[model samples]
Target: MKHHYWEAPIVIYLFLGGLGGGIFFLASVFDLIVAPGAGPLFFAPVFFALAALALGCFFLVFELGQPPVFWRVFTTKTAIIKWGAVLLTVAMICGFVWWASYLPLLGWQWAAGLAGLLAPVRSLMIGLAGVAGFGIMVYTGVMLSTLKAHAFWATPALPVLFTVSALSTACAAIALSLGGAVDAAGLGLLVEELIREIVHEVDIVLVIAEIVVLLVMVLSFYGAGNVTAQKVAARWVRGRTAPLFWGGMVGGGLLLPLALYLAGAGTAASEVVAPILVLCGGLLLRYLCVYSDERAPIPGEERYYERLKSSDTRFMTAWKQGENKY
Candidate 1:
């Protein structure tokens, strides 16, 4: 493998992309089934989820090599792509505004009173924005998977995998933030109860699925027998990227979370410790994936092949001329 650096912009792009897409998807799912009369209590998750998605998008735009070029995606005559981009932009803005007005007061004395008044309206907008954001999140995965050069991320499963990981990470973030708030308010028992009831079940399932998908992905690379793919897999298993693949991504993100959930299910001690440990592990995975030096090809590999048309033409002409003399 060649020595390639994973620059800061690329790292930010990976992290923000996953974080934003995941939060948006989770919020959408919740709004669809849980919103109608779940009360203002539900909004705690909704508001924070949207805020995280918004912050992720902010980082994405900030990391762009040419920030001004981003505007061109909207102005261009490309209808399908333009519409998707426009929808994401609109949803992000609306969701951010809503979250800003709601999340800060989750622990306030008058939170229930304030949310009681605004719940219906907030639920409606949150649902609409969440749906649109889900599409955008999936689109981010498609954008990466389309790149043929980086075989590691070229599989159709990349989008689905990204979606799952994103959702899991967002859930971890919510748990952590809520835990911190609960601790500050001296309500540690309530926090522990919440973890047992909510975080344990949902995150356990998510982590298990993530681990399975990761294994399948790695195995597929080994079976394919492509040199480039094999090289990428080697990097993941033993080279510079090993820490991310093993320690941060697997150990911290999936294994640790799964162990905590198992411990909590079997004993009382884990009830207090599992969620906190899982939250830290998830954040560490996010940071590693963002900062790791792994380069997957962009969506324009075909364009690179197209750009070498002259070389192909010369080779074809020489072969034809040589054969004609015989």
Candidate 2:
């Protein structure tokens, strides 16, 4: 009956938040900068980004135990969770509006009318959403790093790692959906090829950056960290968590994708297989970080908790409210 403060819901929430945020940010770059007049090509990714943000919010609220009062997050101005709520809300709203601005290109007459009305503020919404999206990507890591009790999470390198990973995965997601969206928009093969080349090239750099950062974080902890951090680093290095960290994350996630991008370049291996692996690695990164909640226990704490009956039994079931017979 091992228990931790954060669990699966939090993990999913973190992963989805970064992913959704990254997608929105990259979508903005593609639409407004990289390929202007190509807004129609981004409809699918924007839709998926909005969905991911909504789903992540749902999971966050579900994990709170008291869903009815989730709005209380806005009441506290100083709470980190409050900042996250605000960023997520702003990103989703602006992102949806930005996405809607291109509906006319999809042959929706009703949407065309609505989009015309939205034209004036379209660029503003996209810019705002991009700012908020970047905020969410950084916030996920900062939230964890701020938890000082967890030796493994409280590090400057974490936010950097998460941000790089977020952008990398976002590129992968965009690559996966680019072809279909291009066909839908009739944007032509030239545009699609240009966008695909840009995304794949960017992803290669990101994967390399992630590998370096991850190695530095682990090796630093193993070398100079405190007792708990060293223990967790050991688990990731030569201990039980080694296989997944080295083989799955380092090999399959980073190096293999790099090789695929360089060698396979334009083939399905680079476009499809590599991106999927990058996504899996992104998810695995969050899963590992969330589970690395091993705190440095105080003296006598372990023995005291081990001897407590409440640790093994449900305290509420020990007695009924009015059934005391003593």
Candidate 3:
């Protein structure tokens, strides 16, 4: 069986982390700047962001196998994973608190006191979470790019691609959940519609940016990168991963969604169908990138591994101890 260094868990963790970070960042923009008096309108998105971050962290720890070993990440200051862990923790804590600040709106008497206590510093907490969330979105791609051995991943475009995709997906998520979460009056309903419209427009731009960055990254490697990178890029361009890359990501993920958003604008096709496709594309991007880890092997390494694979399995078991038990 062929072994993969990073598996589904890592892909999931990266996707969820970027998504959560984007949601938090956008929520902060809406609450603190876009509509300060309408902070409660974003309560649902913030909650979803917190949940995503928490689940992403859980997957990260679970991927470590021995979960206790996850603590070792904080013991090192220079490691990229260490910084990611810190950012994730900070984003989660602050996001949770910010989300909690609106609990009284649910008519939960038990949460009224907690909500009141957090009301004073709610904006501050949100600001902190937004910063940390942005960091997490960038960190996901930066972490992959830092692995210099993997020629396909050590590129500048990856970070930009991931960030843009994160924001786009987050915008979609917010648009999907924004209406249901709000309990506003006549004017408030108008503001909600305006926010949804803004989100749709912003997502269209983000999707375009993601397409540009993704193509630049892949085509650059395919055209002029080293042998290892070229091989990986080939897989994405016209080889095994081509269908998913072109069909799932480019066609369905980017172009179709863009078309839907443009045609319907803020209608169900744009708000519902397009956003769902964007999210799926975002997840597929992570899956493809994580699996495209191609390490440039030293001389003779490839042949050596091939020889090992072809070697007779019985040869190893054929040997016995000095007792001649064979």
Candidate 4:
């Protein structure tokens, strides 16, 4: 039996953290455009992005078994994990500072004053958050791929692949919110009329990027000859995990959503459904990444089997020759 130290909570952390980070990064770019009403428009995704990040952090702590242990990553030289911890903290702080002005209940006087004072530097704050957000999103995949022992995840393309997925999921998240997918009763809070426009603005491009990146990642693995790599790649092919991989992540997550967008059928219903599919696909993709690697045989196990077969082949050949002589 293999030991999978990082399990579901960690998976959740990767999924949500990457997602939130992508949202922050995208929103930061939008916030800087400086259109007359663009501040309010971009700020809508800020709260959701912050919430996603906070929840991702919560799951990360949950996986650590103690909240205090998470802080240790910042103090240690754990590479990507350290980067992730610091980046998440910075992004969260900036997101909070930038968005707190809109919240009416949290000591509005000081918060409002702070927001007013920071208004001049709002773009700067958001810019920092965007940088951190990009790091946080890419770090999740980089950390996994850094596990050199896991031949499945040890890839040059995993980081880029995961980044594209994160961006796609982030767009889905924002589209979902705008489509009233979360709370139809709170429709007034959303600009439903902007749903198709948002999809056209961001998601269409992201969808194309995601498809291209996904193809590159899979083809890279598929073209590899390593037994462990082959096993991981097969998880999405004919293996037992293929159904979920192909059906959940590829079909529902990428293809279906892509089809909807290309057909110009991105109605309010699709605005809700497409994003949900993408989010589900993103979550399921995490599961596939985790389990596929975990399920892969340990390195050298295949060599051991091959050597055993070689010995068997030699013994059978000798036995046949002996019988022929007799």
Evaluated at residue 213, the lDDT of candidate 3 is 92
lDDT of 2 at 36: 78
Residue 40, model 4: lDDT of: 52
Which pairs of residues clash in candidate 1, taking residues 3 or more apart in a chain or in different chains? none
Best by TM-score: 3
User: TM-score of each candidate?
Assistant: 0.68, 0.92, 0.93, 0.80
Residue 6 displacement (Å), model 1: 6.8
Task: Provide the overall lDDT of each model, using Cα atoms, as 2-decimal numbers.
Answer: 0.58, 0.87, 0.88, 0.74
Write the residue-wise lDDT of candidate 3 on 31-116 in tens digits: 88987766788888888888888898888888886898788889987889999999999999999888888887776889988999
Which of candidates 3 and 4 is the stronger one according to lDDT? 3
Worst window of 10 by summed lDDT in candidate 2: 179-188
TM-score for predicted model 3 compared with the true structure: 0.93
> What is the C-alpha lDDT profile of model 1 across 214-286, one tens digit per residue?
7787667766736666766676778777887788778866787678777757464344455455545445544
lDDT of 2 by residue, 76-114 (tens): 789888899999999999998887877866667889888
Q: C-alpha displacement of 161 in model 2, angstroms?
A: 0.5
Considering TM-score, where higher is better, how would the candidates rank from best to worst? 3, 2, 4, 1
Worst 10 residues of 3 by lDDT: 316-325
In candidate 3, stretches whose alpha carbon ends up further than 4 angstroms from where it belongs are 1-3, 312-326
- Tens digit of lDDT per residue, candidate 4, span 1-326? 23367789888888999999998887776556523234455555777888989999898898786777677777877577888899999999988877765443333565666667767766777888888999988998898889877777777677887887888888888766542222222543444445436655577677777777766776667677376677667667777777887787778888887777666454854667777888887888787787656435567876786687787886777778886432
Query: In candidate 4, where is summed lDDT lowest over 10 consecutive residues?
Result: 179-188
Better of 2 and 3 by lDDT: 3
